[model samples]
Target: MSEEFPIQPKFGPFLRLFLHSQLFCTPQLPTQSFADQTVIITGANVGLGLEAARHFYRLNCARLIIAVRTVSKGQTAKEDILQTVKHRNEADAIEVWDLDLTSTASTVAFAERVNKELPRVDVLVQNAGINSKTYAVSEGIEQTMQVNVSNTFLLALLLLPKLTETAKSAKSLPHLTIVTSEAHHLAKFPQINTPDIFESLNDEKFYNGQSSYEISKLMQILFVREFVSRINAKNPPSPSVIVNLVNPGLCFSTLATRNEKPLAARIIGSIIYKIIGRTTEVGSRTLVLGASAGPTSHGEYMSDGQNQDVESWIYTDVGIRAQKKVFEQTMKVLESRKPGLGYAVGL
Candidate 1:
């Protein structure tokens, strides 16, 4: 494992971030209207994703696609957002699309629908993820690794063509924001020493559910870095699609307490969240900012509504090797699902 940072996963930085968010991290509402823009947010049925939908709606975005696993649940979220809108006519702007991250076919279908139906995609937020409390497998891989890492990028890569297409004709640069977490710093790099990190991580003997979640987030940052590099190298410079990652910091949400956590633990976590965690609305501000931020945020990891340095561990020699290895494995998995996807995205 790489040497731990003095500030990350420690009391000082955590406290500082908490205090800053409470006192200074106010949501910066967009001055420019999203009058004709199409915004798609996955896992938008609840939590920060739902709150982000509300923010986009407030900006009068033309098409707000709430992509969730359950169509009924998405409809409910859409209705909830419509209820909050001051004018009834604006309610028509919100639409629900079914997206199940665990299934590659479902993700492909969702992308196809978006390409055929939506005239353009101004923003795509990859926010659907879970921190599974127990070991489980989905689509023949560990659930956390499958949903948070592989499937997350699978969806992103599938949608790249649409984003690039939109940027070709649109006035504003298109944005693809991946919601990550500060927990990424907690990943133990030694666990991923093998050439095939994804397959190694799947071994039950070495499996640690929480650690897997952290590693998945860490991989997300690395993937964004490598992905942006590839796009920048494309001939003729593919339209200015800003690919960035955002950490919402500690937030008061049910993300961790899901999947049969003990009652006492849930109570303790709830109390801590109430005391120190930002509300979902406040935390979603960072997501909103990333989705709307300009060129400066490209390929950046943002926290507390600003660009923050990625942990030094990601820059180490070992870390760079891990990034390339994981990227290759990621491409293998994604390409197996949709043949020729990497070339389509100029990878």
Candidate 2:
């Protein structure tokens, strides 16, 4: 693999990925049932997120919330999941909630609803994300950066208290999993010296959708590192909330080609996906594993149902500086949305 993108299957990483993907047996199912547990999955209208919802429902989770941008689409997903359930009574266990990751206001509204409505949240799967071929802006920010990095963690921070409370009351660790991507290894850590890293990312002169998407994934990983550090540094140390990042690898889903407008690009993507991509069912297993993982998985980067090591570059001096910069900028943006929010979360 290229030195900058070491996670690609081009060198020793290729062999590791090959063994993990092709040689491994089915992922180990969760030994413990989700009985009476509440699970929330974003982007559950389709793809891996929808498949994860099915798996959680089958595990008999007491309350399953499918959060999506479109209520109708989420309802359709809930109905589809219900079709596979063994009993009709289980239909009531699933509810569709509205969430638009493009808007900070929408994310905060969703978080408020969750805090007010849900009694507890045992597992939170931050699975919603987007990639676009052309430049687009949402809420005055680049679409990919807004959805994948800003709003994604905005929702997570807003719900941290609930996760902590649930874990403390139940005497069990609650999981907060953010679905990341191997593409993160490609990030160049642009604008490291800028005060507003995200604003720099939004500048059109340096824009490339693919690179922007990769950088957003990198930001997610960095956020996880910073978030876990802050949680550990709390006065009493909040061990109850276990946050993790997971990469499902390339999967045969619309997520890969949804933004490719050119017919040629779409055709080539489809062929590549057919040849190497895992099914959505298999890809979703990684998300489920991350959600059900234990304390050992805290702040870890998991892939192929295991806590694998991240790229060595993440530990380099330059990488650490970039991570700290991104983390500080991310907190500033989030706290700007709600004053004192970072302090409230112990950031």
lDDT to native, each model: 0.82, 0.83
- Residue 338's lDDT within candidate 1 is 89
How large an RMSD does model 1 have?
2.9
Q: TM-scores of all models?
A: 0.92, 0.92
Q: Which digits, one per residue and each the tens of the lDDT, describe model 1 over residues 222-293?
A: 888877766777654444788899998788766865668778988898887777778888888888889888
Could you tell me the TM-score of candidate 1? 0.92
Indicate the worst ten consecutive residues by lDDT in candidate 2. 1-10
Residue pairs with clashing backbones, model 2: 1-10, 1-11
* Top candidate when judged by lDDT against the true structure: 2
